[model samples]
Target: MLQNLSSPSLQPSSASPSPFTHHSSQNYSHAKPWPLQKRPLTRLSCASSGPKRKMVPQSEKLEAEQLVRSIMWNMNGKEPVLKTLNKYVRVVRTEHCFLLFEELGKNDKWLQCLEVFRWMQKQRWYVADNGVYSKLISVMGKKGQIRMAMWLFSEMRNSGCRPDTSVYNALITAHLHSQDKAKALGKALGYFEKMKGIEWCKPNTVTYNILLRAFAQARNVEQVDALFKDLHESIVSPDIYTYNGLMDAYGKNGMIREMESVLSRMKSNQCKPDIITFNLLIDSYGKKQEFDKMEQVFKSLLRSKEKPTLATFNSMIINYGKARLREKAENIFQKMKNMGYTPSFITCESLIMMYGLCDCVSRARDIFDGMVQSGKEMKVSTLNAMLDVYCMNGLPMEADMLFKSAKGLGIVPNSSTYKLLYKAYTKANMKELLQNLLEHMDRDGIVPNKRFFLEALGAFQSLPAGMETATATTVVGSPLGRSKT
Candidate 1:
């Protein structure tokens, strides 16, 4: 059993909050937070005991990524990543361990993260550093392991690591990921208030960014306004990320007025709009189907000094495709190419989706075939996009035909492909097609779970009752099907 290493509940008063001392050594600025853009893999200058926190060379950084990738590639699905970490205990330093946190966090291997932390504690170089705890808290938080995150916070204080802005920020983020979001926000504000008092734990720009985005995501307009006001009054000046985060949250939530208001605030502050700023406006307007505004933003982006990124083009293409503006979507694609932008796999997929939405099946397939013939590595999503187009156009047999040849094309179908096909086949009332898909799923060792059935049955719900009953019986009796409990 993996040991339970969580100490007592966090008593912030018990630990003497140490003033952060910057490392004078040219190689390190260990006392500071790991830059958010870098995460665990970015660099190796975390504050820790002993002499290990130093500026690691690029080779060392690559070594960490390579080591994690190798472990992931070699795992037997059940062996603990900690088991692999054990073999590399000597080679794995603080930087390598940090990268491990990120990679494992991606896979939601939060327990393994704890196990790795426990292992790190036994090592001679181990120190109760805020960066390590902040990262652990972040990983657990992302995994929705709120209790675990809380434990790590307590453990950090117990280990004599003083809580800093980064650690508190991570904790606040972890709470926000919890199901009781209202409670989480309250706790986050509580912490934000607390941070103001503690000189060493004072809220920084990151702290404000986290809260601002959180409130915006919750559509708590009043709170967002208050936070923004508080931010402006504070010593910390908002950066591009500040406006971008606010705009993105509001844009995604369809709070157009709030989004535009934030953009205006960004302008009033004289923070020049970057590519991200333009892209967010385009996406927001496109989502609301306000094509005129989207195009206006696009035109402005063209006039700006900043170059449009792949996201800018991809958003335009997909949104145009969604609106069945095939010519416009095509024009955007042409413009991308004319401007020397090579189409990404996602770009190709967007074109496929666009063509399908516009009833241009032949055109979509033409692009797919061209991509395949060019020896571009076929991704499951790309294939799924093509299959989805066929299904959307009432071409079940065609989708099955392409799906059957997927392995031959060096593209393997995952559960998503199976789910897509099953839903489509069931809705079409094609028994043979559904059975064949089930067979393929079995061969791929994918057992259809309740969620899969629920989604497939959701498609069945709109059909005549007799047809729904008939298809459900077929599903339950199939070799690979398990009835929902």
Candidate 2:
């Protein structure tokens, strides 16, 4: 017979129910803790002095219940509640009230999440669970709070809750999301083995897939191949997710032949490709400019009776735009509308990019205007595409306007965006715009690439008054040099 996991000795037929699982739904009874007697809300920390805030009381269970209801009313999403709760939380100690904290943690409220975690520790009803700690760890990971995530993982163990496979997976994924790839990969591998060490908490297919993705992202092709061999050697079977990860990695690394072989292996394994699989293949072919192969994959996806998703159309349009295949890309856009799939932010971004690439500035502007009219949020890529199109067609003023619009809309321009605007000003010899954009990039912490440096050098060379060239290459073994912008 399968044993009840919560309690081993309590048999289903003959034994009394365990107390842990016996919390009655009707009896909401608890002796009030001393903290609940004073204020209804506890104030933990105060930052900007605007108004006095209250924390949910620790003692009054009913008060905590009402407070939760009020907090829930104030919260439309995690961000708002997190901001409000950060100033408040010290008074509330009820387990039910911890829902606010957990939600905040799940939603990337890193600091508030820690405050709640600490608050839970001080509460009498706080029974540490692997689930709670794992959640906190995942939140911290997502928010780039790696140190905090590790601390919570260790705290879970110290609190007598054993880390399970799920907890390890969370940790691995967190590290993987960090900006430092080498360190993240090393950390993920460490957790992978730690999960494997426990007899009951062995690494599963999901665990391997996460690691496989990490290795692939790091471009460790040798590790990817070894993982496949190890999977075949072990009892674990590779699934669709595994194949998709490998194909994506191979495609990204421009290893088209290896990607095809992996597709063949997927077929031999009888793992029917899903939408994501088809999207990967199409995107890969498109990136390689193998449009014929890309079209073939698109046709196969359509014929397979699996409906094409937004990602499918977005990939096609973006690749076609990049290749300057304007007509065919537009046809796909029309077909998507005909198929009843509404254009998303990505779809609009692709179309703007496509028209921009084809030098159809008016058409790109039309799409941008439509996006605004429909109240669709504009992405930085869309703004960048528009800016690039304007600059390419000798419309610097229009480019400047779009750049200002991006700033006004609170959209920070990336390196590519700044690069386009910089080139525009360079062509027109507009020193102010040119200097300003470089400063903007610096302010935004976006590192200018070789492309930016090269463009600036070209601008300096194109100066009318004098050429920035070496006056003499050899003069008594002293080579001449010129300064570039």
Candidate 3:
């Protein structure tokens, strides 16, 4: 059992609140009170210390096992929960260990599940049964452990367990996800052919869905067409998952025409689009900067009775704000409020950027300042955004001051910050200051790129009379470079 490490008490360094110190007051102009704290989640059992026990009662073990099962179920079948359960299983010694392993594998905890499987093999009660090996192989394949999964599938047959279509589909999915996808797909096709030859185990719609989704995600549009043709020839009908996977793949890959074609195909097949279908289309449209199309999809989502999740609003806010359509962005921000959706850090960041880009520097600063006051932790990205706003509004002095305060608070400036400083220094035409910053950038691993050096050279060329004459570095040979002509 891992002991919980207590958080150390660290004090803030200065008497005066650093300008970089977080302000927690949220912008109530458009957004409602977005609660920052969520209900405390049940800590992973492995991360928490267990009670000391000596020969625990069967009833006690049963109660603890039930609690573990509850945790596993509530986590929506995640791998972290399985890892925690496996650790707890060792401590409690439960008979339902295999069930835990199965659930673990379903959650993609293949390595931890394998640990339990190997442990089972060492036990006297271990039986090389078909169901056991099939489950193990299916789990391994789902996790992309194709070689191990295939070996287990063969071993199952050797141990007298019959091969099934379900087992074959799992292996196919695993093979498709493998790094050597072409090789895996070839092997899958061979297995499919062998299944047909045997006549005992036949490929089903599920197997075809797996193959379709694999081709879709791989962006092998040619292979997708071929697979569809083969499926039609075999009379294996495609399902909603098949279409949804293809839509998502096309949307993600920025193939708008391909995505629309798939949607048209789905409609022709009499398949009604779902919320996921609408969401993916909207997301893809937004990514393409096709705001008009994105809005159309969003409206369709509402008409379909699918209550927009936080994700839906977040996408709109960011996309609109990025396009500098502040009015539309603010309207969505207000709508999110009316819907009882509180603005997150991401929302605030979008607001800051939107305001900044629109030349509303003071408003952007107010949002940033209020965010800090509201106890929301300012991420480095947010800080950079504020810093950019300062520099852009001809306030490099203020930007430099903020940088100093940020550094004191241990917020290391990144390359973006250096770039901003280079721009600021050149605009100010402070040769000594620029040289000092160049040294600082080098120290911070922000090596000046060609563009940065060109900007610096341009600033030097544009320097005022006395500024250039007194500050210019001398070249050994040239008249002005050597001594004043």
Candidate 4:
């Protein structure tokens, strides 16, 4: 047995507070200031009018993105963009300016993109890089700005940034974007041959993909086969993207056997079919009205781990609708909803058009109404779908009503909308509505071109002789009617 140590002598002194109590009641007022340390000296100028900007530690990439966004937001025109950029070119890093140039290029502002490129060239810190030129060339090509893209290639060479496979690929793609397909293909092939001769500029997988896609789109089967053979022989292994590109091009051209062969080859290569591969197969089969094949692919997609995307459902719905399988289309739509996939504008538009085509105008209207009630942004296509349904169902009055309320719905009717409405009004002999539409077109600066006249004449030609005379009599008094008479 041990005696309890409760002696007074073992207790803390009352005059001195315990260590914990002392810390808890710290005397901040009497605390000594930390000793000042000498900071590294930076050069200062008294001549500066404003206080120097504090160097905030941030990622160069993030800063670059912010600078680009700032310029874009303040951009009024090319001149303004140049002026604004001039102020920042010195302050921002070189890599940031490159990003800015890419952003402008992506927006289809090719002239502004060129200005930035030229501005970058003039900068003291600017070093020629293949990436910058390749990106610019790709963008210019997408917009069919072939001349600018070619000039950029020349500029890149002059800047000592030797053109690589990527640069050549972009050049080939730009040429393919031109309206003269045959000429463009010839130029692309010329570049391909040129690329093959140079060891440093040897064509890569992207190079092969670009050429194969262009040739396939042109429906040049001989060229596609030759390119495919060349790709196989090349050291660079073709990826899924390469096969997908060829498959899409072939599918669009109605080469079902060729597309399937590509799929089989993809499987043999041990390249697992991704979502895009299945989507293309489904869409192609649907277009061909080969429902069994389409269903087989859909089931295969489901069996695999690859999740069905919005595109997958859209293709299924569109195809089912095309085949007049209304119940099947609706079932797919319901399934899409159950899978927690939100309906997009394209989805709504497809359903509306499908229902309208199947002579279910009420169901189409219901879908359109649901979209509106759900606060979804109604696109011009959605409006067109509903208007088309009304027109197709011989309900021109309803179509006219929707057209009149287009402004309220934030829809700026394009020529297609006008054409649909005109056809309906003309057929129904709604002279008042037709005249109003012509006036609206004039007001909107939508010139009634030859296409409009030809379509209107064709519509009238389909009517009985008596009805045609009545329509002419109704139109003759109106402004456009007088010109026609």
Best by TM-score: 1
Residue-level lDDT of model 3, residues 303-413, one tens digit each, is 553456566776777677667788998898898899898777767777777787777888888988797788755677778888887876777777777776776544678
Tens-digit lDDT string for candidate 4 (1-485): 00111122211112322211111112100101111111223422111111133353457446657777888876754447668878776675545555665667667677887777777668665555566677678778888999988998898777656677767877888888899999999998899999899987888777787788778878888888898889889898877667777888888889988887777676656565556677788888888989888878777666665677787888888788878899989999999999999988888888988898788999999998898788766788889989989998899989988888888877889988888888888887787888898888768866666667677767886686688777766556556654432
User: How does each model score on lDDT?
Assistant: 0.77, 0.66, 0.62, 0.72
Q: Give the TM-score of each candidate.
A: 0.85, 0.69, 0.56, 0.79
Question: What lDDT does model 1 reach?
Answer: 0.77
The number of clashing residue pairs in model 1 is 0
Q: Stretches of candidate 1 above 4 Å error?
A: 1-56, 59-83, 483-485
Worst 10 residues of 1 by lDDT: 1-10
What's the CA RMSD for each of the models? 11.0, 13.5, 16.7, 19.0
Better of 1 and 2 by lDDT: 1
* lDDT string, candidate 1, 1-485, tens digits: 00110112210111111111111111111223332222343333444322234475677567778877776665546766667767777776766677777777778778878888898888776655677887888888889999998998898888766787778888888898899999999999999999999987777777888889889999999998898889889888887667778888898999998888887777667666656667788888888889998888777666555567777888889999899999999999999999999888988999999999999999999999999999978999999999999999999999999999999999989888998898889888899999888877777888877777887778977687699888877777777756233
As for candidate 4, its clashing pairs are none
Residue 385 error, candidate 4, Å: 2.1
Q: Per-residue lDDT for 143-207 in model 2, tens only?
A: 88888878877777777666666677777877877998988888887877777678756776767
